[model samples]
Target: MKISANQTKNSLFQKIEQVRHRQGKVRDSHITLAHGSGGKAMRDLIDDIFVSNFDNPILSQLEDQASLNLASLMQQGDRLALTTDSYVVDPLFFPSSDIGELAINGTVNDLAVSGAKPLYLTCSVILEEGLPVETLRRVAASMKKAALKAGIKIVTGDTKVVHRGAADKLFINTAGVGVIPKEVNISAHNIQPGDLVIINGELGNHGAAILIARGELALETNIESDCQPLHDLVETILKVCPDIHAMRDATRGGLATVLNEFALSSQVGIRINEESIPVREEVKGVCEILGLDPLYLANEGKLVVVVGQENAENVLSAMKSHPSGKNACIIGEVIPSPPGIVLLKTAFNAERIVDMLVGEQLPRIC
Candidate 1:
């Protein structure tokens, strides 16, 4: 049977109408104070955007709080892992990702590094009055997509509208919950001498991408934010090395900060060779021109893991097999002397202490 073009068009329109009927569309083109006034406008916006995109069994119930079964979670681990982060990236949308995905990945990584299987998340967003509704739609869709990819659910959320100029267009806060397996016990205090320091991927991609996105330096590059979920990668590593000592997602303070933290917490010295660290040329150029250290720049999808010597090879090989950990390498090793310090061995064969920075070079990069 041959279908007419008119029939196809009518079918498409019918589908669109069905969606609109199920999830009412926001009548306003832009957000207003009324949308956050706890009235009809608020209901419409939530039903049309967030609820529609983040549709799930729990969220669809539209309860004030999402309830989870403790028995189901207990099957995965004995302890719960919870992490919260706020994303105020200067630009809500950037080269490869937006604040929505950043919020999801940041919280997910925080839990993943602790050897947990992420379960649920709560997203709270504040939108400035006069902001375009389309922007919010895109963000909501991104969050839903990211949550699906990470195999987690955004069970509940809140929204608010602030006066124009009082807010930076949008700010999102997220709280995540996960379950740590009974056999896994990862912490910075587990670090020991002869342990290896390994990173999952190239450092500073996110910082460089945001810097280029801002167009502050009048420079152009192919850098894109390395924003992604790392739970899968963590699972891969654990499959091969269950006794992993410590793990941390290198975020705002970069790898240097994470290394310093591990060193200080474990009271052991960490020495990283400059040559072993992987950094893209674009990031190196940006850092050199601005007199900034790439080690101190932020990374959204990078991990720093310290493993004992016997399991280092297995962990490195396991990580390399995973996409997120393709660039995994041992940048340093733990030492007995010079406790509570991190030293970087430069390309010129000189050693210098790597200290924690009082501030981040790229603020609001998320």
Candidate 2:
């Protein structure tokens, strides 16, 4: 039986509405071990939460794996970029964003900084026993919103429930796939002496925000996590300078770690101007009080960019023009001396070595 286009559309909307109604019933409910038993309960949980929120043609198929048409994807770019990240942020919820949003954005940024156009994501969640179903609902909703904002789809995912104490309240892991254009050639090894180093914005807000959220610090400040997806931002910069030397999202170890990786990979010295490095006043105060170096803190919505000297101005101008990179600035440059080392030149005319973190400064931070 052939159905008209209008009939098909109406049928889809009705199915979506039915799923939404099921979600409401589980709104104030709690997740049980049966929800992960791969039975009727599991189906109900998935339909009421994930499927209802992330409805799409591919996902609606409800297959074990999502199949994509090679010809259709190949038209987008020449190469494929894949990345995976897990979010175990201590507090599932934070001021600016939550674990669900962080998981989606983090994976998207990973693909974006690799010079790729994020296309799809696979989310796997580990739910602890006794977790509120409402919590999962909120997280799923946030993930849906974030994926939509990033112009990607969560085509496949898995959910498992662990015994109490076997897992935290919840943990989410996301794997993403993206397409990279043939002309874009970005790599840490491409960094050269005289290449200018740039950062998208202020540092350490995510780390500080997480610390405060954990109640580890008594002092309060209006700092929030700089958690955001950067594919659009990267696209803007690439439009201006396609030959960027290196680009990385400052994640766990922050900008310092990213610079160290570049220095080591390119076997060149990176000199950063301590004064020029942008650190928000509130973040600086939190760092000062806690004896933490903002340089070593984590950031989600920031990127460290390295570009040729001649294209530095153009790239910086392009970055600054974008909302995400409004605070972008050239904080340093790569040099030939002291190969494989990062140096911070302070305003007082003193140079100090910036090394990779020996151990985790802050754990369970996305």
Candidate 2 regions with alpha-carbon error over 4 angstroms? 1-12, 25-28
Q: Root-mean-square deviation of each candidate, in angstroms? A: 5.0, 1.9
Q: Write the per-residue lDDT of candidate 2 for residues 220-277, one digit (tens) a residue.
A: 7788899999999999999988998899999999999999999999999999999999
> Candidate 2, TM-score vs. the true structure?
0.96
TM-score of each predicted structure versus truth = 0.94, 0.96
Candidate 1's residue-wise lDDT over 131-223, tens digit each? 999999999889989999999999999999999999988999999999999999999999999999999889999988998898777898999
lDDT of each: 0.92, 0.92
Off by over 4 Å in 1: 1-24
